[model samples]
Target: MARGTLFSSIAGGGLLIGIVSWLAGTAPAAGVQQQSPGSNPPPLDYSLTADSQPQPGVPTGSLTKHVLAPGKFFPGTPHNYQVYVPAGYDRNRAIPYMIFLDGSGYAGNNVRVPVVLDNLIAKRDVPPMIAIFVDPGVMPALSDEAQNRYERIFEYDSLTPRFANFLIDELVPEVGKSYNLSKDANDHAVAGISTGGVGAFVAAWNRPDQFRRVITWVGSFGNFRGADRLPGLIRRTEPRPIRVFMQTGRQDLVNYAGSWYLENPRMAAALEFAGNDVRIELGEDGHSNRHGASMLPETLRWLWRDYPQPIAVREPQAGAGRGIFAELVPHRELLPPPSNPAREGGAGRGGQPATPPPAAGRGGGPRGAVYALIYRDKPWEQIGGVYKSVASPAVDKDGNVFFADLAENTIYKSDAARSVAVFRENTRGA
Candidate 1:
């Protein structure tokens, strides 16, 4: 079979989609279709032709390459990145900035990001900004036979806060040492394709204080280690000062991991549901750089539109209602009293004064009443039976204790009645 056909058969025509469709009672149809809020329109051809190249009167920018040594976040790995400084850049002033992942693939003539930036900046379509294109890291092999460790999946696909920390704490600061990059989050943006697209979203989502604009193309928001939960998170968390633009194709990857085509629409809907500034563009293309590169110029324009006008966080819409946020936001009725009335010399049941409880840490008390001394050579009574190993203990409002056992990979709960039971099992090898 042909390579493309083989991949499609393995990914789209496999048991993964079949099982999902069976469970949902509907099968996903083939072909690309726009799934936006309003009337869906055909995607425009943003592909660069002869007319799209460098034009007269447009000042060209400088492209420089640099290497970043692995830092505390991803030790022993190194990365290569490039920077595009727009023409007429002044070192004295802070310039708007953007970071793109999968750097090498985007810096070529086909993408022509630098050229597009020059034209856009000259036309006043986008603010003159510095673009940092960073490639994924790689760990060197110890021997000839051993394969080099690819850091792409771990750095991009895994939804860990460490990647964001690496970008904010390491990469940005390293870049800022030479160039006067804007410190304002609203002046910063992140973009990437495929898995890198998800990484861009993760960076902005985790630290909206550092990045307010995000552009993702064919983001891998599938079962790649909890990324599928992003839509739910967007609905539940307080809306941030973020402007997002997502582009995906109908024939994008559809495998056990997830369907890129469907995930982006879900993300856009969730963003809109949370009252965020979001846009989703669908196309008839597949998982490739052609569509994304073609749309890069327009994407930047939309991202930096109304430049210097700080992106604002919107109030949660009442009509949109709340997801987990409703339970999280503090309310007066939900708060417990500062002090327990019954414990503070107030009447107990039947309007009678409650008995004064023994004072803790006091010198003298009734022999058996001084239970605080239980640790002093006394036979300690176990409220609940012992477990192999206990960790991450927590209690609820009703005095029910919850904990996890790492050895057994089980979560257990002990109620106020001292009864214990397994709360959960097989917690993803936790």
Candidate 2:
């Protein structure tokens, strides 16, 4: 029943999702979050960028739909998922992929995600990847008059890992049967809006081994289904290896559930407080995903920026919120390896059950894993002043950069205007 330009692919198959029950259901006049079906959705409209629109030279991708009926996780419910393979997607190679929790809206006309991905891929802003638009399961109607039950709220808004487990244990493996999907968590991303947005974060939070990048648009993060506990959980638990991009509108007001606008910031603060990589955009739109959709291209770019690099777990930061999250999480054992009660330390990956011998010992023979050079956000930046070899570098009080070129035996200064000129010549390699 869905219609669009469905291009053929080298095995690129992802489903398009529609509105979620949580998103589409406006609980009568008691909730002012949504408009009547006939009225305009957002209070104010957002402008889509050129990247979000199709261009003549840009190449589009192929999209295919699939269904997971009577899935083991949610028995008797039918879940339909879609995959979008970008132009020139290589089926032979295991390519990075992203998941859309609530499929229809994003995969369908509302977000037109495949179109945006095509444009960004053309510009090389984001790598050529596959997208999985997974719709929540719907129970079959028992009879002509019996209504089918929607599983959106139960699955998307829950604090537990059941939904994520379904994706990992069932949906992903099923989809992987068709395409060479990346198994690396760093190569995976998850996204959603509204309750789907909460679901996205919850997925990455519970299963960082499956997805490390997350984007949530106007996530319903309040008390509904214990999501209000996320900020506290993020602050208390060991920092997960995840990167997040979030957006919320000031007008995404409070309801009987909680404040959409407020919860997003709380989530962002907790992520930042834990020293995780996170970016958030606050706009003037409402609970709708229009503004977030407009920024989708940028969001993908940010989420997938510096790919192939491993996303590492970080120690909590050092500040006020940091003070709360700074303490190391409880491990099975507290003592050093070989001495702890568990006595099984210094044995496995990241040491043994109790944290193995090395703080100094673990066994990889130096070249320590933690000491290995890892790239986080903005790992290394080019500050414009480039020379063959720099022996000394200094910055002025006013922020001008000065460096000495060792081989050239000259010192150069890059002023605030970013102009590189010789400050002193013939320094004699000092």
Candidate 3:
């Protein structure tokens, strides 16, 4: 294994491809290809190159740097932990915090969390919070020929609380020595991408009392490191205090362990089944940082919404969402509404009360011209505000028509004479 930035530790050897294929169970897909008998193992191509460098010029407002206390986890070896303290952080008032696994990767390459956090906090898109980026610890090597840096797979892949404990019992208290931190789990979040993503979920699942928010990008939930059983476990285990955000690309790794697409969605289903507040986004790219970078800011906003609010596992009502958004635009409202008495009774031709048109407008009939309501997405100035469009229109017994704006989920009403009026706005539970 290499020892530079943790992102550089990706095993680029050919064995990794073979390992991935085997883990993803490519045999079935390959078996259909009809190969010769006794073809030991397929040729491995592990030269899959991807970006592993952190981007430059990230804004770090109020973020502080903290060096880990030597002799804590990897005794006698010191490591650096980067902390991003959001604006309005008060020593007298404890604030929420986030712990980033694979710190070197997230802090540098993907999402550029420091910059996003700074901008979001400044704009009040999310509450002020702190982020602690910690890298994996390495054990001392006995000799040049006999070295040990395998801690990544062990600490990251394990389902036990050892890793979580290392952070809460050791690293956290050490940081507390310098700053005030709320011990409430709801005030804390843990996040990462790839292997670290799975590790983030595991930490929160094992100890929700210490971490209630989780964000994972391209999480490896496959059989590697005994993580393949996570879905089944989540199905059986009681729900925990976790609001999760997951993202993966269709082109992500496809190996014996399975594509991040298949595994991440499966984990998402499990999380949702367990009543965890989870959001999963699928992309079209491969195992890369591009999508993650684009989604980071929004994902963080969703995760930290209502910080201390305990994540509840309420079964989604079968018809609640349907009724909530169904009948988006009323049928009659899709066309122009009928006119007043002039067009209502009969008569209407160049200022002269000529013969009436058809019963339902156009066609030709004795009854006045009955115009149909038509829906439109036109910009309009109403109620002292500007609106994009009108949707979910309804008509009253008196022939008054109304509509709601899908963009803002607002309702608008029009008189029987086709005059538009503002009704209710700020819908979708406001």
lDDT of 2 by residue, 39-78 (tens): 3544455667787777998888988878986767799998
Q: RMSD, model 3, all Cα superposed?
A: 19.8
The reply for model 3, stretches above 4 Å from the true place, is 1-60, 69-78, 148-150, 315-430
Ordered from best to worst TM-score, the candidate numbers read 2, 1, 3
Q: Per-model C-alpha lDDT, please?
A: 0.69, 0.69, 0.59
lDDT of 1 by residue, 1-430 (tens): 0122234454545544432232222433321122222323445464674324889877899999899998999999998888899998999999988898876656665566788888888989888899998888989997999998978778987677788889889988899988999899988998877778889999998889899999888788888678899989987777888998887765566666666766776677678656677766666556555576676777777788888899875543333322212112224223312323332211101121133333322222211212233342468667666778889987664446789888888888877566899899987546
For candidate 3, what is the lDDT?
0.59
lDDT, candidate 3, residue 184?
Answer: 80
Q: Is candidate 1 or candidate 3 better by lDDT?
A: 1
Model 2 regions more than 4 Å off = 1-45, 320-430
